[model samples]
Target: MGLLDLFIASTIPVLKVLLITALGTFLALDRVDILREDARKHVNNVVFYVFNPALVASKLAETVTYESIVKLWFMPLNILITFIIGSILGWILVQFTRPPPHIRGLIVGCCAAGNLGNMFLIMIPAVCKEKGSPFGAPDVCQSYGLAYVSFSMAIGAIYLWSYVYNIVRASAAGTTIESTRLITGQSSRESSTAELGSCTEPLLPSKEPLASEHRIDQYALPRTKQIEMEDSGNKQLLSKLLGNINWKTVFAPSTTGAIVGFMIGLIPYIRKILIGGDAPLHVIQDTASLLGDGAIPTLTLILGGNLLKGLEGSGMQKSIIVGIMVARYIALPIIGIFIVKVRLGFIPADPLYQFVLLLQFAVPPAMNMGVITQLFGAGETECSVIMLWAYALASISLTLWSTLFMFLI
Candidate 1:
C-alpha cells in the first residue's frame, strides 16, 4: 500500500482512542466532575476485579482453540520479547532521567507495557473492516483477528501482573521505606558519623588473629553439622524467595479469568457448554461479554480523569516525560521492526498477524499502569502526567509507525 493509504488506515484506530480519551477528559473537568477521585477509584475497582476478567474470559472462550493455540505459539514469545526489550529501554530512560524514586517504576512500566489488550482488540477488527484492508475478507479477517487479540490480551494481562506488578509494588515499598527512614531521623550524616567513629578506634591488632581463628573454627565443624547448616541455609533461602512472590498478584482476578477461559476453550465438554450460539450456557458468556464491553469506555474515562491531573500540575520533570516518549514511541518501534524482520524467522508469514505484531510495539503505554499505580498509592500524579503526554503524542507516533509497518509488511 502507498504511504497515504497506510496513513488513512492508521488514523481511524488512533482517532478511536483519541475520541474516547477526550470524552473521559471532559467528564473529569471541575464543572462535570463526574469522574472524581473516588468515582474513578470505584470504577477502576470494577474494571480490575470484575469487568476486565469477564472481558478476557468471554472473549477467550469464544475464539481460542487448540489448533489456534499451536498456530499462534510464536505470539506469546513475541510479546515476551516486547516486554524484555521495552524494559531494557525503560531502564535506559530511568538511568538518564533519574526521576523521583517513587516514579522510577512508573517510568519503566510506561515504557515497557504497551496498551496491548484493548488496542489490539480494537485496532485489528477496525482495520479489517476498512475497504482498503490488506487482510482478507472482513468476516475471515475479523474471525482470526479477534482470536489473535484474545490471546494477546490474556497473555498481556499475565505479564502485566507477573512482571509489571512487582515493579510498581517495589516502588511503593521503596517509597515507604524512605519515608519511614526520614520519619525516624535516620539520616546519612548519622551513618557516616558512626562509620567514622568505628574507623578511628583501631582495635584490629589482636582481633585479626582471633577473627581468623573463629573462621577456622566455623569451617572445622563436624561434616554432619556442616551439612545440616547448609541444608538449613538453603531452606531459608528458598522460603525467602517464595515469600517474596505476591500470590495475590500472581493470581489476580483478571489472570484467573484468563485461566478459566483457556480451560473452557481447550476442553471439549466445557467449550460445548459455554461457547457457540446453541450452547446451553451461552447466556453466561453473553452476559459476561456485555459487561466486558463496558471495560474499554470505563477504562478510557478513568484514564482521562487521571490525565486531568497533569493539567493541574503533577511535579514530574519534563526530561522524564521526554525520555519516556523517546523510549516508547521513537526507540521501541525501531526495535520492533528490526526484531520482526531480522530476528523473528519463526513467525508465520500472515499479514494480519504481522500487522498486529508490529502494532504492539507502536502503541502507547497500557492504561492499566494507572490502575496499578492507584492500587499501590505511589506515583499516581506523576504517572498521570507521563500518561497524559504519552497518549497525547500517540496519535502522531502510532500513525507514523502504522504507516511504516503496513508498508514493510
Candidate 2:
C-alpha cells in the first residue's frame, strides 16, 4: 500500500482506538475508589474470576485451530527474548537513578509483557479493518491475530511473575529494613541513657515513665514546630529498578488460560467455542472470530492508559520516549531485515515469517513496566510516564514499520 493508503487505512482509525480506550479506562478507574473497601474487593473478585475469565474464555473458545496452536507455540519465545532485552534496557536506563530493589521489578515487568494483548491487539486489527483498509477484515485480523495471541499469553506470564516479585520484595523490605529501632536494638531511647547522667537509673526502666517534673511530655508539640519538623523530614525514596519477584502465584491465570486454550485448540469439541456459526467444520473459525474480538479492546485499553499517563510530555530526558519509537519501529525493523536478508539467507519472506515480524514490530512497550513501576513505588511519577511514551510510539510506528518490514523483506 502507498503511504496515503497507509495513513487512511490505519493511522486515523488507530487514533480513535486510543480515544475510546482512554475514555473507557478513565471511566472505569474511579470505580475502584468510590466503591467501599468491601465493595472494591468484591468487584476485584468478579473482574478477575468472572469478567476477565469470560474475556479470555471467549477468545480461546472462539479461535482454536491446529495452525493457530502451532503459531502460539512460538509466541512465548519472542516474549522471553524481547523481555530479556527490554528489561535489561530499562535497568540500564535507570541504573544511575539508584532506585530501590522493588523498582527493578517494575522496570523489568513492564518491559517483559508488551502491550500486544491488553492494548495493541485491538488497535492493530481495528485500524487494519477500517472501512478503507487494503486488506479485508478477515485477512487483517488473521495477520494481527498470529502476533497478538502469542504476545498476550506471554504477557499473562509476565503479570504473574511481576506480581509475585513485588509481593515478595515488599515483604522482604518490611521485615529486613528494621524501620522500628525498638525491635532491632538501635532505638534512640537506648542512646539517651548515657546523656541522663544520674537520672539514667530512673529513666531506664522497662517503660520510660514521665516524672511530674517532665509533665510537658503529655502536651502536644506546637503547631509551627510540628509543621517545620514534618516539612524538613527526609522522605524515604523507593527504588524499583531490577526488583525481586514471586513467580508461583503470579502466572496462575494466564498459565491456566493459555494452556487450556491451547489444549482446547487441539481437541475439536473444546476448540468450538473459539469459532462461531456452524458446528464441526466451521466451529473453529467461528469461535476464533468472537474470542479474537477481545484482542483489540484489551490492547486498546492498555495503549490508551499509557497515552493518558503523559507520554506526550515525557520528553527525552525524563523517559526515552522517543527511544521507544526508535526501538519498536527503527531498531526492530532493522533486526527483522537483517535476520530475513542475512541470517535466513534470502529465503522468500513467507506469511509465517511476516506474522512473526508483525507481532514483534506492532507490539507496544512491555506491559510489565507499568506494573513494575507501581510495585516498587519508585518512578511512580515517571514510570507510567515512560510507558505512555512507549505506547504512543507503538501506535503509529509499530503498524507502519511491521507492514513495511514484511514488504521490504
Candidate 3:
C-alpha cells in the first residue's frame, strides 16, 4: 500500500471515534443535559458492569481457541512489555512533573495503558478493507485481524483492571491520606495555639522532673519481646489493610469476563456448545455479542461527556499532557518498533500480526481510565483533560505510526 493509503486507513478510525466523541460532548452540554454528571455516572456503571463484560466474554469466546492462544503466546508478552516500559516512562514523567497524588495514577495510567482493543478493532479491519492493503485479501485479513483484536482486548482488559486500576486507586488513597494528615496537623496546630493563648503563666515549668534515660530504658520491654510485639502489630495492620480492599473491584467484571471467556474458549465441549452457528446454545453467544456491540459506542460517548470537564477548566498542567503525548505517541511507538524488530524471531511471520503488535504500542491511553477515575471519584476532570489531549493528538500520531509500522513490516 502507498503511504497515503496507510495514512487514510489510519485516519478514518480516529475520525470515527472523534465524531462519536463530539456527539457525546454535545449531549453533555448544559442545553442538552442528556449526559450530565449524574447521567454519565449511571451510564458509565452500565458500560462497566454490563456492556464491557459482555463484549470481552463474547469476543474472547468467539475468537480465542487453545491453538490460537499457543500461536499468539508472544502477544501477551508484547503487551506486557508495552505496559512495563510505558509505566517506567510514566513514573519518570510523574517525578519530573510532581503532579498531585490523585492525578499521579491518571498520568501513569495514561502513559502505560494503550487503547489496545478498541483502536485495533477499528483500525485493523479498516486497513484490511483498503484496496492496496499489504495484509493479503480483505476477507482473510479481516478474519485474522479481528481474532487478533479480540485476543488483544481480552488480555488488555486483564492488565487494565489489575494494573492500571490499582495504580489509580492507590494514588487516590494516597491523596486522601495526605489531605487527612494536613487537616489533622492543622487542627492540632490550632488547638496548640489556642491553648497557648489562653494560658496565663507563659514561663511556668512542670514540678515533676523528666525521667532519666536509664529509668525509661528500665521500663521498656525486652528487646526480643518488643520485636515480637512489633511483628504481631505489623501483621495485624497488614491484615486490616487487606480486609479493607474491595476485592470485587480488584477482580473487576471485565477481568472476570475475560477469565470466563478463556475457560469457555479453551474447553472444546463448552466452545462447541456455546460458540458456533450449529451449536445448540449459540443463542447465548449471539445475545452476548449483541450486548457487546454497545460497549464501544457507549464507551466513546461517556468519554466525550467526561471530557466536557476539560472545557470547564480541569486545572491539568500542559506539561503533563505533553509528556503523556510524547510518551504514548513518540517514545512508546519508537520503543515498540525496536522491541518487535528484536523479537521478530519468536513472533509469527504474519505481517498483520506484527502490525497489530506494533500498533498496540502506538495507540492512545485506554478510554476506561476515565471510567476508572469516575468510579473512584478522583481526578475525573483531570483524566478527562488528559484523555482529551491524548486522543486529540492520536489522529496524526496513529496515521504517521501506522504508515511507518506498515512500511517497517
Score every model by TM-score. Answer: 0.90, 0.61, 0.88
Per-residue lDDT tens digits for candidate 1, residues 189-229, read 78878888889566557444565556544666598678887
Tens digit of per-residue lDDT, candidate 3, span 1-409: 5788777776787788889999999999999999999999998899999999999999899888878898899999999999999999999999999988889998899899999877777778888987788899999999888889999998899999988998899899999998999879988999999998998984666566567634554576799668877999999999998886667776899999998889889999999999889999999999999999999999999888988988787667889999999999999999998889888489978899999999999999999998899889999989888888877888788888988988888
Instruction: Give model 2 RMSD, 1 decimal.
Output: 13.8
Better of 1 and 2 by lDDT: 1
Task: Give me the runs in candidate 1 sitting further than 4 Å from their true place.
Answer: 186-232
Candidate 2 wrongly placed segments (more than 4 Å): 24-49, 71-73, 127-185, 188-247, 272-333, 340-349, 352-356, 366-381, 399-403, 406-409
Q: What is the per-residue lDDT of model 2 for residues 155-264, given as tens digits with 9 covering 90 to 100?
A: 45444444534543563365446445437575556666656754636645686665765555346568866775566553312223322334444554544555555565
Per-model lDDT:
0.87, 0.50, 0.89
Ranking of predictions according to TM-score:
1, 3, 2
Q: How many backbone clashes does every candidate have?
A: 0, 50, 0
Candidate 3 off by > 4 Å: 188-246
